[model samples]
Every structure is written in structure tokens, then in C-alpha cells.
Target chain A: MPPTGLEAVFLANRDKLVRFLTARGAGDAAEDLVQDLWLKVAGRMDGPIANPLAYLYRAADMLMIDRYRSRRQAELREQDWAEGQGPEAPPGTERAVAARQTAEQVAATLAGLGERTATVFRRVRVDGIAQRQVAAELGVSISTIESDLRMAAHALAALKERIG
Target chain B: MSQDRNSPMHGVDTVAIDWALRMADPARADWDAFTDWLEADPGHAERYDRAAMTLLDAEQALAAHPDVPVPIEPEPVRRRPLRWIGGAVAAALVGAIGVTAWQDRPQPYAIETAAGQTRRIPLSDGSVVTLAGLSRIELDHAEPRRAMLSRGEALFQVRHDARHPFAVQAGAVALVDLGTVFDVRLGQQTRVAVAEGAVMVDPKGAALRLDAGQAVTVEGDRLIRSTVQPDEVGGWREGRLAFDGAPLGMVAEDVSRFLAQPVTVAAAIATRPFRGTIDLEAVRHDPAVLGPLMDVKVRRVASGWTLEPRE
Candidate 1:
């Protein structure tokens, strides 16, 4: 059968997607990533998307993020294993200490933000509540909630940089 | 270069974060504008990726520090219009009448299984239910066509009757068999997978029809549908547990059901995604074998076993 909707769009822009992924530093895996994108689009059961092209690009971006995460996790695991075998300290102790420190830093960062921004971040991120509902509960507009989340994200980015 | 608020690059970071937040709601995202922004400059794509990664890291950090208390106000009671209140009163009166009729029906009895045990229950209507370990199911002898799985997992080979459809309720979600063999697992999320024939998930709400080699995971009000291998639906019955990017916490829960002692996962690696098949029989004898299979350190705690990240 001929492709339709998102599938059709994907087929026409397959090369463009490959270019995009390559430009985004996918390197040799650009083709494979494009294939994965095809599989995702083919398996999707949802109705027609509002912007098929943009949706495909967004999905492609997320795919890259997932790849980066798994790769980073594997590297961390290997590094930890190597470090565990060293004579400097006992195995797994450093990981626990680092985790505790990161947690403390995250808590301090949240505490340092404005009360409203911190509350909004907690309700939306920690509690998993809808931003619109949180806005309604706080007697604020959705844009206000979005702005608060942005501020929280900015603070977190700074924290991650410091931790690094 | 310094990344202070006054830096020229700070504007890019702010816009990137804003875009990331907006893109969280994919259905309503202005993707055209986002793509335009991304294509406007190569640095924009890089900044956007960092923003997205930062958000994810923040979520993980918060998850790791669950003990950190953030004061939250109690939920406010929503006030309904007078017309809606009157409608609700009438609906309650009708529900009371229905309850009176329902009270005459036979009570549903519960069937439970301990860890490392499985029970095969043959219903009166010719359907067979294979309840997994550490699971519970409620069945009514008088009405053999209905069952409720309160926890854990079960495989149902439903005998389809066009006049009397077989229905299985898992939490708020309900699955009605349409000449089907399906597996339902209840945990932090509800999962329904059809092995043979078809099933209707959430028949009263989304009413999604899933056929063979199809599955759906219901989390909150969202129903995410995906494809699954038909033969792998009840692989646990064959001493194999298959996972495809399932969180370690959920995998540990499944593994715990097959052993005399429960398997516990550390909070740090609880959300780590694992994809592989575990040999339940092998792990049952020596839980430490999970260390190699799952790339984690398995330590025998006082209670049972703990799976921690290799780190």
C-alpha cells in the first residue's frame, strides 16, 4: 500500500531527515536512526497529526536523546566498574557519596529558587500534576506556570554545570 | 566563557528552555515555529538538546531525593454549577435503584496465589485463567463470565460468547474479550496485551481495540499503544521473563514474584531501563546471577536481595 499522512511525509523527507540527524552529530548511525524513525511512524496508531513534518523532527530529536542517555549510562557503568577495581577505595562507595551529594545540591537549588517557582516546579514535576490544573489551583495563567517552569529549568541547568 | 545571565548566549538558553517546555505537549506544540527556530542556527539545536537533557536530569534528581519535602497546599474543592448539582442528585437516585438490583447478585470470591506459585482456574463458562505468582483475582460462580484482577498478572483464554461477552476489570480500566487470549498486568501502570484474537481496552472510555501482537499501557488518563510479540505474551509461564526497555523497578517486581524471597532494586537504578530476558529458574537458585545478566550488583540483604547499579 502507498504511504499516507505521516508515513507519506516521512518517505518524501527521508533524505532530509538523514541529513538532519547527521548534522545533529548522529554520524554513521544516521541511516539506522532514520530506519528506527520509520518503524516508529509505521507502528503509531494515533490519528492524523497536526504537523507531520515537525512531529517527525521532534521524534527524531527524542530518539537522539534516548541514544545519548543509554550511551552515557553504559559509559558511566564501565567507568564505575573500572574505578571499583582500583586500590584507592572500596567498591561502590564513591557512587553512593556522589549520589548523596547530587541529591543535596538538587535540594539546595530548589530551595534557593523563589517560593512560587519552586512550588510550581514541585507540583508539576514531582507531583506529576497537569500544568493547566496547577495554574487553576494557584489562580494563575498557564503562561505563568510555564514561565515558572522555565526559571526552574534554568536553575537546574546551572546546577548541572556546577556539578560537572 | 562564562554562562552568566548577562551573557549573549543566555537568551538562547532561555528560548531553548521555553521551546522544550512547549514541546512537552506534542499535540498542541507549534512545531513549525520550533523547526524554524532550530534551523535558524546550528547553535540553536545544540542549546535545545542541552535544555531537554537538563530537564530530564532534574526529574531524575528529584526522583532520587524523594525524602526532600516540598510543602504543598491541599487540593481545593471544586464548586459545581447548581444545574450540575441537580443532575448529580438525580444520577445518585438512579444509582441507588441500580445498587438495590445489584445486591441480589452473588458475591465475587477472591483467589490468591503466593510468591513462586501459579494457579490455573477453569471457569464455568469454559474460560481458563492462569494467575501468576503474587496475584489476586475475584470471580463469581454465579456469573462465570466476569473477573477482576486486583493485582499482579493473569493470562485469560476467554471463551467468546457473542451474546455474553467476557470482561476483565483491572483497576479503572476494563478489557472485554472479542474471541481473545490476552494478558493483563497491574502494577504502577496497567498493561493489556493480546496474544490471540482481539480485545477492547477501556470499553467505557477510550474503547481502544487491540488485536494480536498489540499491547497498551494505561498510565493516568493516557493510553499508550505499542506492538508486542504474540509468542512472548505469557513467556513467564515458560520460565522466561522478557522486557523491552522496562524500568528496573518494574522488572524487580516481576522477578520477586517467582522467588521465595523478594527482589529489591535500589532507588538510584530504579528508573534505569533494562531490556533482556531473565532465566527465572537460574535466578531462583542463585540470585547473584542477576548481577551479570542485568549488569548490576546483587547483594544479599537481611530481607532478601538488592539490585544496585554497577556504579
Candidate 2:
């Protein structure tokens, strides 16, 4: 039997969706999201929807945005603690040296990012702005905001691999 | 480096960063799906945590000396955001004195062993070293007993000295004895296995404190932690070579080392898994003994011995 249009879309882009979510910082969770997405599509879709791929991408993107929005405050609190807290030891201490190395590596990694991506990364990570807000201010769509964040994060992960 | 982009985790890193960035926002959030993502994979949360921790660390370092103004600052903040960071680091260093302690200095004394050879050397301190075959180590009798394993492996029976810690550096990784008996093997990859007591392993920026019967593999930037049987700590030194589903190629390498003869595997059998033990002393005289046991035909080539699949 010929696969339905929805099934065909799911088959073709399922791996791409996982890769997309994974690049976006889902890590292992990306697999689960894909599974969840599959379940959502299989269980709910009885009628034909126009542009299933776009709908799928939008649905996945929305799911991620919702996930991010759900725990936004606590994450912000942790970010404030990490960013605002003073270095535990005095200057030149071993802690400082370690921190300095980490800082240098992070700086070097961020320096290598694309100009726009770097700016987006800094605004979200350093300035602690919401992705939605960054998109609003920069006159870009939320999808662009997500993509930029993913690129920045992927770079940071590579940095960790280089130094960790 | 080539594998960095194509790695599966890179995709996850993006999602993790996305979530981290979103969480940092002041907007209201629903954390259930986020928790679901974290709970889905064992490494997902850990990777995210590391990225988040690194960001926090950079932030803390940048904010270290907010009061101390940097000399010769850039006029426009946007022109050089890095200058601000440099100023912060310099300000932090202003109060620091004699940071030379972290530099790597040349050690004075050295000990090395050849193929099929082992040595038990006593140090100035109470620590005793059992050097492995084809291993080299440099010794430093300073306040903290230090040794650099340049090649091969060594088993250390360190006496408890709280005032002076015993440390061994293997490549970028360092194993610090917190009063323990541990065997550290340096090769293509460094492996540290603790027999008795505990040891702390520092690989680049990450640190792991291993207890008795624990082992870790330090390969490049990755540290793989695993459990080790106490008896398996220094199995090679006991005249026994054991293989636990090890590749035939590696087995051949060990066989070569033990027999002091070149034992190369045919390309076809290189990856074949070999299990069971080879009594090195018994096989020392007849290198061909491995042929029957490994189910291979050992052919004595002009260059060395080659193990090929049996007909």
C-alpha cells in the first residue's frame, strides 16, 4: 500500500527533525521529542493538513519554544547565580587560573562564531534576554532566534570537546 | 576535530543552549517538557549542565574584579567587548602573586624499563614504584611527590603522607594519590586503575575522584570512567596477559611486547575479538603458542611473525 502523505513527510524528515532538535540543544532529549512528535502526528491527524513539513517544523519548533518557556525563570535564576556570583577565590588563586583558562577558551570559541550568531549568543547568554525578546528587538522571527541559539550552543559544545 | 561537527551530541548542544537561553529569559515557562527532555538521555542533562556551568564560570571570571578599572580601555564598548574581558582578567591578576606554581618544570630524576622488563624502585619518600615493561617516568622529590609518566605504565604503592601528596602526570591528565595503591598505564591512551585507597584524576578541566576498584580511560579530551577489579590492576606485571574481548590487533601488540618479538595480525583478523588469558612466561620461548589458542596460523615472516586466519 502507498504510504499516506503525512506518513511520507514523517518518514522523510523524522531524522532531520531529530538532528534539528539535537543541534538546538535537546541532546538526548531530542530523541524523545521526535518520538513525542511522531505520537502527536499519528494520534491526532485524521484530516489532511496543508504543507505537512512546515506544520511539522512549526509544531516541533513550538514544542521546543514551549519547553524553553516553561522553565525560563529557574534557568534565569541559575544564570544570574553563575554570572553574578564573584569568583570563589582571590585573584591569581588556582581557582582564578582555572577560571581564566575556562574564560579564555570560552572567549576564543565565542570569537569564532558568526558576528550575528555571536551577538545573539551574548544577548541571550550574557545579557540573559528571552529568545522571544531577542527576536522582537532584532526584527527576526522566533525560528531565526532558535537557529542562532543552536549555532552558538553547537560551537560552545565543540569548545568543551576541545578543552574538556 | 573533523568529527566535532558530525558528532551526534553537537545537535543536542544546540537544543541544550536553546533551552538554556530560553530559561534565562524572564518570561513564564512550563518545565514539564524540559524535564522530559533531560530525563530521556543519560548524557543529555550532563552535557547541558557542562555548557551551563562553563557559561557561569566565564561570567564569574568576568565579574571577578568589577571594582578595579582596566587601564587603557576601548572608547566604544561595542568596538571591543573582548577588551572588557581582558580588563577583568588583568584586574583579577593584579592581586595575584607568583603564579609560576602552575607552570610545568623539568623533573630531575628518571627511571625507565625496556620490553619484557619490569622494575621496582624505591623513592626518597616512602612510596615504592613498580615500573612496567617499556615504561619511562621522571621523579620529583619536592614537597608533593611528583612523577611524569612519559611512556608505558607504573604501579605505585604510595605510603600515606597527608602533608605531601603523590602525583603522576600522564599527558594532559594527572592522577593524584590520596593515599592509595594505583597502577597508571601510559600508552596510545592513558588508563589509571586504583587497587587500594583512592585517587583523584584531573583530565583537562574535568576532575574525577576514583575510589578502590575504579578505573578511567583518558583519551584525547574524553574521560571514560569504569569499574576495575582490584586483581586486574597490574595483570601484566604478574607474567599473565589477559584479554577481555580486546581486539586481535591490541592482543598482537601485547604479545609482541611480552615476547620481545614482532607479532603483527593480518588486516582481515585485526578486529577479531580475543578473550581468555595468555601465560606470558610459557609463551615466551614459543611465540607460535598464540596461533593455536587464537585460532590462527602463525607464519614467521622475514620482518616478524604474522597471525592469519586458519584455513
Candidate 3:
């Protein structure tokens, strides 16, 4: 069968996606990333996408982010092992400590923002509620919810930089 | 916040953040505009990536800290002090409310076991519940005789009391122990097998009484009754699963509980019936062994193993 919808877009822009991945520092793994992207797109049985090209790009970006996160986690694990910690230490002890610290830092940062902004962020991000639903429940406009999310994102970006 | 929005880097960062957020919801994202912005500036893509990463990290942190307080609306305050007679009436009302609240309190706690792990919990009533891997059972401290198996499998050895009988709720069906030892596996269907004594399946509904060595699979409103060997009722506890004409999908689900990785059957063969005893240890060592053992083709996927019919 001929490729259609997102699959067609993906095949047509395969080279562009590889270039995009390489530009995002995928380097040697760009081809592998593109393959992974193909698996994701091929398995999809959803309705027609509004902007197939843009969707592919965003999906590619997400794939890269996932790769980065997994790599970071592995590095963290290696660092823990290299620190000469005893092997008897329960698994995930270091992860739990790091997670607790990050959680506390996030709580403190969100506490500094407006109550509504912090609540909005928690309801949408932490609680996994939809943004539109959050706005409706909060009796605010969708634009208001967007602005609140933007503020939360800005604060979190600063926090990440500080943590790094 | 307004001052930060006015900064030189803010223009690009704000738009990038907006794009990142919009992209999260596929229905709302303007991909054409997003693509244009990315091509317009090399820096825009980088900024968007950073924003997305930051959001992801923040979400992970919040998730890890489950106790992070969510600010909910405050309760309404009472404006007037109670009069002497009114105070007595209010105190009586409070007492009634307290009793109701005590009885209607939420499920006190839940016990969950990860995949490839099992937990044996002995209740205050001398009943022992052995939960299978990848299973969750919710119990109320106030009521130890009741349990709700939300997912996975569990073996119940009840210290049956005629007055306060042990009841297990799996899906829409309720199994009340009639002085019995039974195993209930909840998945696409709820399967219950009695090793000893008897149990009433859905007293209010079908009210089917399953005696020793009797098994029933509850699917929707239908109850499929069959006989099982008394010894093999909860044989999974001994790492032995004997299926007699069981669907491939159900077999996969049962096997998946014993292995750290998931075992999934291809859609084409998902409903195919299989009759056999699978040694989980051998499959755990080499998932590919299942292909020859079950006379099917097993392909190793990134996440786990996928079973397919031999072509």
C-alpha cells in the first residue's frame, strides 16, 4: 500500500528529519532515531493529522528528549557507582535522594509563583489533567491557562539551569 | 513576570515555550507555524528543546514527590456562634456525622506488588492473602474482611467466619468465601477457582456456588463454569501454570506476571486457544523458548516478547 498521511510526510521528509536530529546533537545515532520515529509513526492508527510535517518534527524532538533523559539517567547511575558507595546500598537509593531533592526544589520554586499559576501548573502537569479542563474548572479563559503555563515553564527553565 | 517577559531573550524563549506547550496537545498545535519558526532561526529549535526538557523534568520531580500539596478551595466558614440549645443540637449532629464518616471512610490503604514479585499478607482475622506479581489489592483497616483486587492475580485463604464472611471484589463480580481457599485472577475476565470449601460468585447477580475443584470465568454478565484439579487451582504460586484451552491473550497475561518483562501475543493469535503447562523459569531465561514450547513464533521486541502464529 502507498504511504499516506503522517507516513507519507515522514517518508518525504526523512532526510530533513535526519538533518534535524543531527543538528540536535544526535550525531551518529540520527539514523537510529529516525528508525525509531518510523516505528512510532507506522504503528499510529489515529485520525488524520492537521499538520503532518510539524507533527513529525515534534515527534522527532520528543524522541530526542526521551533519548537524552535515558542517557542522563544512565550517567547518573554510573556516577553513583563510581563514587565508591557500598554495593549493599539498596537499589534506587541515589535516585530517591535525587528525586526528593528535585521535588523539594520544584515545590519551593512553585511556591514563589502566584497561587493560581502554581495551582494551574500542578493541575496540568503533575495531575496530568488537560489544560482546557483545568481552565474550565478554574473558571479562567484558555489564554489565562496558557499564560500560567508559560510562567511555570519559565520558572522551571531557570530552575533547571540553576540545578545544572 | 511582566518584566521578565520584556527581556530580549524573552521573545524567543516565550514563543519557544508556547510552541513546546502547544505541541504537547496534538489537537491544538500549529505545526506549520512551528516548522516555520524552527526554520526561521536555528536558535528557536534549541530553545524549544530546552523548554520541553525543563517541563519534563519538573513533571518528573512533582511525580516523585506525591505529597506536594495541591491548593484546593477552602471550606466555607460558619458566621454565627451556636446558642446553648443550638450547641447541643450541633454536638449531636457532629456525633452522628462522625459515626457515618468512620463507617464510610476511604479505603485505608492498598498493597501492590511489582512484576516478578509476590507478597504474602496475613490479615488481623488470621486470613492470609498471597498477591501475585503485578497485582494490587485495596483493604480498609476498618474492615479487614473485605478486599478489592483492582488488577492482577491473588490467592485467598480465608479464615471464614459465618457472621463476618470474607469478600473479594474483582471487577463487577463479588466472591464471598464460604469457608474456602480460592484463587482469583482479574484481567480481561475474572477467573475464580476454588481449592477447597465453597464460594458464592456474585450473590446478588448470578449467585453461582462454586464448590471444591470448581472454576468459573466471569466475562461481562456471563459465567463460564469449568472444573480444575484441586492442586492446580493456585499452582502459579509454585511457578506452574496449566491452561486447558485458554486463550493466548490470557496465557500471555498470566506469564507476564512472573517475568520482569512483558509477554504479549500478536493480535492475529491473541484469541487462539492453547492447552499446556508453561515452566515460567525457562521462558524467563530465554523468551524465545516459548515459540517452540507453545508451537508459535516468538519475536523479541524492544520492550518485551511478542508471540505470533507460525506461518
Which one is best on DockQ? 3
lDDT of prediction 1: 0.73
Poorly placed runs, candidate 3 (over 4 Å): A1-164, B1-107
Pitting candidate 1 against candidate 3, the one with the higher TM-score is 1
A best-first ranking of the candidates according to their DockQ comes to 3, 1, 2
Model 3, span B110-182: residue lDDT tens: 9999998989999978999999999999887666777889899999999877666677777666777877789
* Shift of residue B10 alpha carbon in model 2, Å: 43
Q: Rank by lDDT, highest first.
A: 3, 1, 2
| Backbone clashes (count) for model 3 | 0
- What is the overall TM-score of model 3 with all chains considered together? 0.44
lDDT of 3: 0.75
* Model 1: residues with Cα > 4 Å off, grouped in runs: A1-164, B1-104
- Residue-level lDDT tens digits of model 3 in A1-164: 99777778888999988877776657778899899888997787588777778778778878877776776667766777888763344458886888888887887556544467778988987787988899999998887687667666755665675576
| TM-score, chain B, each candidate | 0.67, 0.61, 0.66
lDDT, candidate 2, at A113: 38
Q: Among all windows of ten consecutive residues in candidate 1 chain B, which has the lowest summed lDDT?
A: B76-85
CA lDDT, candidate 2, residue B259: 60
- Candidate 2 Cα errors over 4 Å, as ranges: A1-164, B1-107, B141-144
Measured against the true chain A, the candidates' chain A TM-scores are: 0.68, 0.43, 0.71
